[model samples]
Target chain A: MSTIARAPEPAKASLVNDPKVRGLVYQAVLVVVVVGLVWAAATNAVENLRAAKIASGFAFLNSTSGFDIGQTLIPYSATSTYGRAFLVGLLNTLLVAAIGVVLATLLGFVLGVARLSSNWIVARVATVYVEVVRNLPLLLQLLFWYIAVLRSLPEPRASVNPGLGVFLNNRGLFVPKPIVEGHAWIVFAAVVIGIVASIAYATAASRKQTRTGEQSPVLLVALGLVIGVPALLWIVLAVVAGNPIDFDMPIKGTFNLRGGLQIFPELVALTLGLVIYTAAFIAEIVRAGILAVSKGQTEAAHALGLRSGPTLRLVVIPQAMRVIIPPLTSQYLNLTKNSSLAVVIGYPDLVQVFMGTVLNQTGQAIECVAITMAVYLTVSIATASLMNAYNSRMALIER
Target chain B: MSKRIASLALAMGLGLVGAGLGATTASAQATLANVKQKGFLQCGANTGLAGFGVPDAQGNWSGFDVDYCRAIAAAIFGDPTKVRFTPLAAKDRFTALQSGEVDVLIRNTTVTMSRDTTLGLDFPAVNYYDGQGFMVRKKLGVASAKELNGASICTQQGTTTELNLADYFRGNNLKYEVVAFATSDETFKAYDTGRCDAFTTDASGLYSERLRASAPDDHIVLPEIISKEPLGPGVRQGDPQWADLVRWTHNALLIAEEFGVTKANVDQMVKSDNPEIKRLLGAEGSYGESIGLTKDWAVRMVKGVGNYGEIFERNIGEGSRLKIKRGLNALWNKGGIQFAAPIR
Candidate 1:
């Protein structure tokens, strides 16, 4: 009864005066302007292309490329369609990016940890490596690796043979390729079965440890299952079927080493350059991630009678991973994109083969550039989402 | 919501009007007028192909292709020096021309069906008649290209030579690996370092590149000529007037050379009585005006860069260090196939 009369409801505001209406109007205008710009740009391009008398469209993908790539992952020739050439280029790019990511991460982690080591020599060496590598431009490093280091190697006639059917020369590194003959599927099936069994065993062992407070040599057992199963079967097949696996050893030919998997110097130099350059940045990232873990956490683990190794692995690393994942994804993306410098060294990567050769051949500037851009966008997005998913999994779970 | 829709419609209307205006501006095709306004001809030349289009230590460009660009400038502006050279890579030559960055591409670009039609380019005339060939080290003992089976060949990318190398090897049922670089220098360097067994390019280019080798005498060009490469000056396809001007400039040079017009004697030849020479020297009909140039256009061109024979000799032929024989580039009446249309 004593409650004051509520203030009269504000008079209905005019549409122009209403904040919500103004925001909606502004947004609508912005959307209209954006759409108009895009429409205008597209139309202008079409009009210009038409006036220039340049043929437009994606039909040229079916045309013969009439060019040969230095390094091809798939079967390709001058007679191959431009579409096939594109796929070959894409696969080559993916191959380098994948290998670069894995090797760079491993080297980076080692260097990062070594930089913080108690041994002065190890720490100083790691610091010098990171500083020197990161300070140099990636393109310069690539050129140095290709021209100064790899190209200076001996010619094929005087190739450096470090035994074991491996040869190194200016042309390439030729290594014996393992040729699996007859019932290769059986070997593949064994690998799959071993991996499945090892995973199941790991789960069961962890459950048992929690229930009975017991421990098992989980890593040792997993490794044995994963590697031993296939190896045992391989030996058995070799005895029964006169060697299911044989190595095609490389032999000196007239111009180069023949009859082996030839890893061209372009690939070697590109990979080496990318790995060394990206590892420097990744080392700093890893160091920052490691240092971000609180000192109290380490002390607490030590007080609980855990050693430095276990404390770092179980308590500190798990927390540090939460800090490491996001930046690590960026470094991975940078390495992938920077691989385009392969064109300078004739690596036959996506930019080298497709954008450079294919674009010049077809003169489809718009289409080729659009496709290359779209490819990079897709790859970046895919890589970002994967790291984001991993980052979410490692995030703290608060009650 | 209705207001938002109305605003969008209004914005779209304005955008359409702007786009229409843009279309009208883009359709303007007076290249000569544009070049005149700029007061210089933008010519695309090779980045560095020695006798074809190489810059000297003083950064002054003087080569066969560079002189061709100079001749064009003389035809248009009556001043040979009223031109600029944009050195373009093999991969970027056509795009540079297509994007209007250069009025003409006098680079050693081969005239092919795809380039003429699909690339929206017109080849005025074959300034240099070339063919793909191979160069190998004498130590390799490769006497002929036929013996180059299983050889790794280095070549400049984005050229007819690369394609011809592949075709020749494939057609002959031979195996070869092609390592193509983005520049002629890289290709030659790779070959010199023994990264490849052979280097393949135009026969003219082979001779030009051999001079840069550490030991020029060590390498020898093979006798095999693989493909016909009619290297010419190219222009945008839609502008026929510009095409005619370029074509006529080349023809004038050839006609002058056929009538024995040299750079030193071009001034004296203008007073001659030969009907064809008088017509070519712009002393006859209004032929030069028809192509948007003054009556003395050919006179300026010949005086500026000399005729075809003079240009060839001074840049890449006997007078130069290249010492290349005229071969197929000699005039039609003088044993070679370099025939040109009459100025009349």
Candidate 2:
């Protein structure tokens, strides 16, 4: 009836009928919404910044820090620039993360393998450790270790020495620091060359064995090549230079331990907490990786006259690694990021030094927070890339 | 039917999200204004430290720092009980103030240059004069800080004490390895276990900590004052009115002490003929209205909590278990820096 005055209809939109156009519109709307939210946040930040008259920029990084930090790996002082302070914090974070990763991995592998042991007692003990450590809240564990264990130790004068020139006081562990003399670089270079040579030879030997049925004693050969050269060089250097390396062991003085490197109780506890906490997670990963390997494969190797050690070294581990590595990277990243908790223990870590002191000094929150986040993200990404490459290499060779 | 229901649900979800965002923006913007309208003053304080801020068995906050919180509450709301104590740590204290989490920081915080400038906080007045001092086992036969060389000092990190330990040791050429903890309590505990040869912190703090010891007299605070630590109450900068209100409230305790206005006599002193007294007690007007407060705010503070000296005596000084002397916390008129600006 209304056709007498009919006008051509404008297109009515439906989400499904034209998903391309619809998706474009929806995406455009999302972009606008995101941009608007960002704009609002930035505006609010600017207003607050202006109200407080706080300068919002990175210029403060060049400003001299009027405060000082203890135990800086690089040169630092009250006159050090904010940038220098940031580097110190980053270095400390790397230090804790590096040490924690190594110790945790070692502990994890041992526990994971032990949990699968034929010895009932060993398996039960490993299982108990894994369950207890993994289930506990990391922060509570850290506090319990720091306050309940380390801080409860006796003072330095009444310190408990556990041999090896190591002092165990509430202050921390003081141990011998090896001072490497000039010719030490030669030993270090030799070790590096030895390692590369060993790896190259192992790869060739493994490839040859994989192609042919002939066997190569690769593990023994590699160990001999890698360790042998370094030991020989050290001996030669020692004989030629009279004293190639000297040990500066901590000796108790009237009021303090003098001459050796001292690791504070806070640091020791933090490392312990980090290792125990990370090891639990790493153990889970290791377990998963091992289990991912088919049980039938291990049985087959044993049926074919192979022992558990040889089967594990050659077959089961290679398969298990594929399952283990991705998760392993995540755990490693977590350990690195969680190292920020060192601030609570006054470990002078990256987060504590850079974000805590530098932020307090410069009052440049936006820049400082951004830089710290970027560093952590970069480190995590780099670590992940490395592990991923290893994982890819260790992956199965499919027909 | 299913398709129709899906569209309706999506539309409703979008609508709800839009409403939520609108509500959040409005609430965040009006936070500062809402605080004033609410009438109660919010004060941030330390969770537990002997003389600064500690919750008793009944959970009532009672300490020198808590008293200052009450003073601000009294000044603003005319009721000291109107305050809400938000416990904060050394690291989170400034952020809490900046984020409008609290109106004032009365946490026995040391006034430092970095805190003053970078934190965008204004330290209106110092309530306590403190200095870094060492505490050692009395059996060590250490009488003064200078007597201890090569001491394994337990120092709290993220504090000025760490830096001062280095300075003191370096200045005296006394080599020491510093064992650091995140909290003062932990640092002291380390020393208590004989893990450190000495424990170092503020002199006033050491006195309070000594009282909490398993045996109070087992440790003695050495006489050597390493560095000045002027502990004070601070508030956010930029709000001059707010800053002045907090400052005047802090300074009143000192002013009241100087004028002999005790809790016992404040009611009588309110009607005194002295021009300073008249002006301070609200017998005169227009002075406090400038800071958006009543003229009787000073009288309310003095009456609510005794003067700064009275607070000190009750919490940490000779009247308390700490038995700390009024060596540096005395009124400016009697040789301290607790000076109050005149009401005029």
Candidate 3:
């Protein structure tokens, strides 16, 4: 056996020349620099605030907020604590953001599908809508919706009665508010039960279809159980004990409507503006996502004797979702942040009620601003993580 | 990686905290010296209140508050043109003064205990004795503010007017919705377009805003004055010299008006034999020197913007379209509460 000459053993690198040692040293320096900067900033702020004689700290949150908000989702008054006022504003912001996200997504999917239609008029209309809406600044659109569309409506005295105890005017759309009297919890329980039953039925149906190569109308069954059970229970409860729910209809007062759930024109204008603007961008995103799905997939589905609808729904959509989700997450976050613009129209969102009125009243600018920033950061991170979890589930599993 | 992220987040949080605190640096106590060094006086005025601090089509500011700024500039530099106006909203006025963006704030601010103590600001003198009031459309036939129950009221945000509206309505046990806007213009416009049944603000502001309405005669000012709003100029605290200079400048205006000294006749009155006028005009005592100004300080002020009466008349009184009468703002001897300190 020929013995191969072994190569000389390599010498160990000096500490300064070693990549791992150099990286460690650089990281240590970076950490020290960062800590020093934070310390300096904190001390500087403390000194300046003390010198200005401006009261600092979070104690002001307990003080009374002697200002009224336009819209309050919870029990709030001028005598409420600043902390409670902050909560009211936060709820209002979340309400608008949640409604805006759901509505914009539904409208965007429709518009996206229309943009790819074989018909010329349908495609052109969708394209024009996207271009015109996305090009204008959101602020201008908001102003237009508020000043031109809503403000042009007549006064409450001349309000348009759109039938069914509803009034529409510049002040707001007044709809009869349902007041639950008694045994309403029964109806709620029925809804929960119906939902659980439908989910279990859907799972069982899917398993049967996979095993026996048979399909079931799972969606129709689920919808029927959810809606039918709730309606049946509600009607039975009403018949048995007078009425379980009563609607408080609005009455015309001397100056305006007195009762009912009055949606402020500011809220309507803001929601309309946000949904329209954000939908345009989401429509483009959806169209791009659909186009990213390879054409060969659709051909293969058709070759397997699947119809056009099944080919698109089963073979195209699932794959397209993988591409759409990441960008869609960003749009959702942008919509949520843009809700701060409610201040301009007096919607009493977080910025308007808390950052504007509360900060001005307490004169604790640092604490108020820090709280607002932290709230937004927490909300954004929560939204992103939720989307990331869904994205990972939708991710392609490679063997 | 998680540790790195935690540090990054900490850094970002500290940076934001720093930014919020850094914007409100305690300005040096030498505001007057800084103004002189900069060669121009930065005066914070209203964004657009018709008779108080509105800018013209040519961007020339001319209002009661604007004239006060010009008077201060004239007192310091002997030139009324050496002043720059910073138009501020109701919410931004105190911040602007505290941050030293403006040497003084004459934005028709109300003097209140919290503002004086907590906001680190000082009100030199009450320049306009105004009161918060309500204005409603005449077509509504609402005779008094008491009849405005269940009404939607419009007001500017971050003003005492907002608080007073709440207090008044809550005290009377009435239900009313408040739609507060950021600017006075928006508040008035919302009221004009019938978004609100009534508009609540300082009576002076109500009268001024009426002029901008499509039909100025349709609205009527209610008889009730809800709250006392002693509108005045504001300056930062910790600068006693600057505060004194601003306070004395307002006192000089009142004295000039009391002595019947007008802008056009100031030069002729400078040589008068009256001891009070002599001292006020910088002829007898070195009052101006105590405030680090030239001897002709009051004379320059009067020459630039005239007395308090002239300013009120030109901007919002009989000489202007507002035609607001001198009700409570008249001098003490004239059956009003406007009293000035003795120049002697």
TM-score, every prediction:
0.94, 0.86, 0.97
Winner on TM-score between 2 and 3 is 3
Pick the DockQ winner: 3
* Model 2 residue pairs with clashes: A89-A350, A154-B194, A154-B195, A155-B194, A155-B195
RMSD to true structure for each model, in Å: 4.0, 7.3, 2.1
CA-based DockQ, model 3: 0.56
Q: Pick the candidate with the highest lDDT.
A: 3
The residue pairs in collision within model 3 are none
Ranked candidates (TM-score, high to low): 3, 1, 2
What lDDT score goes with residue B214 in model 1?
95
Q: How well does candidate 1 score on lDDT at residue B201?
A: 91
Candidate 1: deviation at residue A141, Å? 0.9
Model 3, CA-based lDDT:
0.88
Candidate 2 local lDDT, residue B226: 90
What DockQ does every candidate get? Answer: 0.39, 0.26, 0.56
Which lDDT value does model 1 have at A79?
97
User: Across residues B1-344, which tens digit of lDDT does each residue of candidate 1 receive?
Assistant: 47645654554445545544444453538899999999999999888988999898888998999999999999988899998999888888887888788899998899999999888788978999999899999988789999987789998888888888889988998988888888888778878878899999999999999999999999999999999999999998888899999998899999999999888998899899999989988788989999999999999999899999999999899889899999999999888999999888
